[model samples]
Target: MGPDQALYVVATPIGNLADMVPRAVEVLQCADLVAAEDTRHSQRLFSHFDIDTPLVAYHDHSDDQRTARIIERLEAGETVALISDAGTPLISDPGYRLVREARNRGIRVVPVPGACAFVAALSAAGLPSDRFTFEGFLPAKSGARARTLEQLAGEERTMVFYEAPHRVADTLDAMAEAFGEHREAVIARELTKAFETFHMAPLAELAAWVRADSNQQRGEIVLMVRGAERKAGATLDDESQRVMKLLMAELPPKRAAAVAAEITGVNKKVLYNWGLEQK
Candidate 1:
């Protein structure tokens, strides 16, 4: 409302410099101060836009003492802008404490939306976007990643995850194992850059491709894994699981799914994968 009463949470471009919105740039340029998750990284973005506003470091690693300082600035009627290194602040990055503190201190929190990699990837993932969940990034360790995947194994909504270049292949392999090798998925990398690529395929195929081509291992990666296809059967009894096996062994996937669908009233495509996963 008033000129000096708000803290703006601004979204910056993920990669492509041109993706920056004019209004976001203007806000950052005019803000009293910018509380950046990484002053050095944010400086690059600020320099790109020629924004000379002073930046104060505020990140997850920073303690409450730092938060107190930022809160003091806000309380003093400074219009601070919070920005992460890339994309939106607080998505998988820092900003929660500052936002909460600002609100608690009666400071207005304004969100100036712009480019977000997860949303951009989801729009083009070709998977069902109507019902989806953003998991940010999975744990790096094998057991942890597997446990994470296991918890989501039965989830029926599409899921998105961010993975570093070096870990994308390993994550994909883990996804294939936990979610089933044939689970449909897509990988979007170097998004909005000249080398931007989107690969849509079965999890197994993507994993294999990544292993075979070293080039696929580079760039910031956004993975979209199709949710577990719900099985429709009268409930998989000994008889049905046996029938599922025989049908999958004897008929093509399409025909098998159709037969399974008829037998259990579950969606054909979903039952088809359930049958395959059974194998």
Candidate 2:
């Protein structure tokens, strides 16, 4: 809006052009400059929208000199728009440094959000969304990826990640090996495009599906995994205490067992028996 006094982090469509928000287009068109992950990619987008703002490259591989140039622009009272090749910038993309620098200089940062693959997949994943974590892109090397997965083995919140087509199968295999074959997962591909597809199944089945069909291995992928189902820090004895407290509230033993099972996904029959033992 009103001549943005700082950096504008704009989100473009991941695949479909129509998903680009009008406010994003206006900011990109009117900004003093547009810093993109790839100048060539941004150029194409700009051409399509007939927005001729100057383009500069700012990516993971770029040098400090490039970031310095962008910071200088913002310091000089210029409103710069930062965008990624697709989707939102700085979500496993660059622009963090520029934003940080601008903030240190007291520049305002405006985020125009739209068309995030992770959010899209999560919303349709039918998984628990109340608590979740985004892991962005995983490490490319096998050992690093394995170690990463092992660290998240006990995590309880749903996790989201982005994986390239070439490595999707391998990543799934690694996940299965680290997390277990029966772990639930969903893979969303070519999102918001003509051939968009969502594939959901156990980890092993998904691995096999990707292996059996070459076509399934193409296009960007958003992978969602159900977090490990684990009890809280409380032990079996602590659970017994919690159940006792609830039962004391006059909730029937069967209803108490059902509620406890729903809370922990523990065996309802076992909990019911425990309730009897307590009584």
Candidate 3:
């Protein structure tokens, strides 16, 4: 029997239907009512799982009255399952209002966790995961997007963003301009579907590649950008990095890198790679 007087925040599959959890299917099947972002779209999922539970539309545009109605049912000890069009609800999808109000009214809130797109992309992006930030979607317009990226130029955490298929190329261009062209990034597209891809390259190359191929511009996209390099040398100390930069202005790249390495006890190859990135 489904737990009553509680909201089960259910996670739906983003692309591949196989990712759906057995518990989520059980909860929905036994729920007294299923609150969905799109009732029609959710109908397909229900039909597939043979979940004949009633569905009520609840989304960003859901009015306070609509929320009041749902809360009323929950208070009456009815089981309500919340599911978005895809993935976990409220991760850039709707249902936050209902969940928020449910908690305020002392209704139980349970998470039936499963697939989440960003979490999956970050796991294999090859970027630092220890300390990362989820920035969600950036501004859609060029000027606004530039300003937003400019503000995050110094972010030390790996940045994650979702972008529409058509605007991805322009967004990558803006990111390359804001961050250095050499900054590394990954494009995860069509996630679990047949055309799934995870292409990682320097920002400039990635941007050019996406621009050149119309195929890269299509499908769901997750963009992961490496954080800004710590000014201190990867192999050397801060003073060594400063000295190497100063010497390169006057000496040849090879000579300056060699001199810096000899004086600082740092690897010459590492110093040389730094010089190449600067150029």
Candidate 4:
């Protein structure tokens, strides 16, 4: 059997129809079967591209038997393409079980990579991208979500999260609290679509803005938070703290942080954050 016998993990567009990659189209058209997160949702995509391949429902809920059937088809020399409702398969979506089992069975698993909302958002987010973490969607409950963010309190690498439209406001407030209200964060909403927007600000400010503007809460949201700054050098000495406090009483926080950094040899941003905490 040739490549057609293997399992194909295809990436569909996140929002823009034009984001669909050509190779993905060819694979979907040629595959013997397409297992989708939602067959009904995938049908619209297939219709747009005039692809009439057989469809089957596969999602996080798909049982072992469903996966076994797909694997058997692949083993029997029938190519099967796995796709999510949108974006790349298995990125906070389903198909992990099928993909892992396929590899275990020594079936060739090919990737048709394309649009990924978090990656696309991170690219234009203006956050430090050299190193980062993808923290998918946070827990919906306040207690679990708070605990989750608390674990990342010291995360120095940029952090990315996917948030539901309904829970956006609550998540932002929770993030601001756990990560420090002054921490920098970016909200990328409705990416790759006509009304797409990217809003960057401090966590507290971003949360406030999103709360005041109902429109920002209505679409797909990718939240990018600047990592906790590593405070280089030793902890602040008594003299430095004394001077910073005195300076803050007289000058603005920015100027106080600058002057304190000069005298204390600590990061100005660090001093600024300390001042914020002290307030």
Lowest lDDT 10-mer window, candidate 1? 231-240
**Residue 221 in candidate 4, Cα distance off native in Å:** 0.9
| 1-279 per-residue lDDT for model 4 (tens digits) | 224678999999989999999899999999999999999998899999999999999998889999999999989989999999999999999999999999999999999999999999999999999999999999989988986786686678999999999999899899888889999999999999999999999999999999999999998899999998786544567887898999999876657989999988888877876765565
* lDDT by residue (tens digit), candidate 1, 44-155: 8888889999999888999999889878887887788899988999999999988988888778999999989999999998999999999998998998888678667777
Descending-TM-score candidate ranking = 4, 3, 1, 2
**Worst ten-residue run, lDDT, model 2?**
231-240
TM-score for all models, in order of appearance: 0.82, 0.82, 0.82, 0.83
Clashing pairs in 3: none
lDDT of 1 at 183: 93
lDDT of 2 at 171: 96
Error in Å for residue 91 of model 1: 0.5
| Model 4, residue 272: C-alpha shift (Å) | 18
Could you tell me which residue pairs clash in candidate 1?
A: none
Off by over 4 Å in 4: 1-3, 233-279
lDDT accuracy of residue 1 in candidate 1:
25
Off by over 4 Å in 2: 232-279
Which structure among the candidates has the greatest lDDT?
4
lDDT of 2: 0.85
